[model samples]
Target: MIRDVAVLALEGSHAFELGVFCEVFGIDRSDDALPGYDFALVSATGDSVSTRHGFDVRTPHGLERLSSADLICVPAYDLRVRQPDRLAHELRAAAERGARVLSICTGAFLLGEAGLLDGRRCTTHWRYTDELARRHPRARVESDVLYVDQDPIITGAGTAAGVDTCLHVVRREHGSAVANTIARRMVAAPHREGGQRQYRERPQPREGTGSLAPVLGWIEANLDQNLTVEAMARHAHLSPRTFARRFQQEAGTTPLQWLTGQRVLLAQHHLETTDDPITAIARCTGLGTVDNLRHHFVRRLGITPQGYRRAFRAPHNK
Candidate 1:
């Protein structure tokens, strides 16, 4: 459903965030049987824009291009710079006309300038979250989440989270298969829940850093088994309460939450690649029954297990 895409190229834009939009929407991946978006880099200020890295990117398109866009993406720009009034007006108009708008990192400030963030739940980079909240007191700015999909206005936390947010919009509009294909070509994770924490500041604690790396591997390898926090605690050689605290400190998520996410991911893989029945897939993923699987699938993914299979199953299987 989201074929037409436009990215606003403001002065001092972060190249990586711009590249994220370009990689997800600009590239022609039709050869791989993926949908090719009608994409444009629209200059919000002028034809020539200077990036934060001290380079110039000249775009032929302008604010008028946003008129036809199904989705308009705003990449992070220098937070200190002010957005042009004309650009803000155009963005507000586009949203008013039912176009979905997405902001990556500090770009949420532009949405705030357009009065779009008022009374809306939104977010920006973790480093800028407090500032964003302070500036727009009416906006419910969640600091920790990867992204917030508030319908018609999605806001990503920071640089890499933009990929997660864009893929989510694609999956919502076009189906998981198309989103997955794009993600594969980009060598990125196909899905990361919006509720997941944006691990800021600290390097993610990993195998060599006293993390539950082996326990995580074991859990993934045995998703079919009924994984319990107490069981995982025993495996990690710690009391349940201590293990829970350590897991949160090291993994940025609770043990049970991570286990459910892994099982759901496994179920998604099976749904996409195999013709296994729902009941069989459910059992294999430790979801217990088809009903239980459907409940979690719908809760986490916003689609039924059968619907996900139908949308993402191999062509031959279909």
Candidate 2:
């Protein structure tokens, strides 16, 4: 249901973070059978805003663009200076009017300044979690998760984690197929496993970096196959315990967790794209039984298969 998206450009905003919003929401991907956003960059103060990298980002749009936006995104910025009161006021008002608000990295500070983060479960860059907590004592700052989705407000941790949060929103609104297509175009993971806590212990993988790419590719291709820890361990040439540990280290999730998530995603694709019965879709996705599929779908997505199809199935397909 989300269509229009407006990204807020503020003084000293991080260029990469802003680019993350543009890349995810501003691009035209309809050629690839993906939905295109009615996207625009809006500045609160003027036509041009300065970035932390000593460059200015110029946009034709202004705060007025935000009024009709279905979602408003605020990217990371230097939080040392005060944000314009008008920007904060309008952001809070937008959320009040049922517009979802998303913040990347330290942009959570802007939400706190807007008083939107107060009494909500939120998070930010791990480096600033304590500061965010201290600044807004009323806000429950979770330092561990990749992102926290408290309905109207979604918060991403740092730079690339923004991708995870955005794709998550897409998956929630559309379906995994759309989200995964977008992820494929971006060459980013369709889903990430762990939290910033895991990243804190080690460096994040650089772009085009992943140790288990081959195994993961194999698993994805074989989602309907019976995959077990022992089977996957053999494929990865590691013992079961070693593979489990290495998988967590490399993928940020346990093997079974990843497999179940894949099955759910596969089930979602079937529900959205095919008129197959729930039992048939469950079997195709490797959930084995309709009850098993129902259990995982409801537990993970909070929606029954029929309900999800009702919401996201393509009109022509339906």
Q: What is the C-alpha lDDT of each candidate?
A: 0.87, 0.86
Determine the backbone clash count of candidate 1: 0
True lDDT of residue 34, candidate 1: 73
Q: Report the C-alpha lDDT of model 2 over 103-160, residue by residue, as the tens digit.
A: 9999999999889988899989889999999989999999877898877998999888
Model 1's TM-score against the true structure: 0.90
What TM-score would every model get versus the actual structure?
0.90, 0.89
Tens-digit per-residue lDDT, 272-308, candidate 1: 8888888999999998899989988998887899888
Q: List clashing residue pairs in candidate 1.
A: none
* Candidate 2: stretches off by over 4 Å: 193-211
Clashes of each: 0, 0
Q: State how far residue 171 of model 2 sits from its true place (Å).
A: 2.5
Model 2 residue 109 CA deviation (Å) reads: 1.2
| Model 2 lDDT on a 0 to 1 scale | 0.86
Off by over 4 Å in 1: 174-181, 200-202
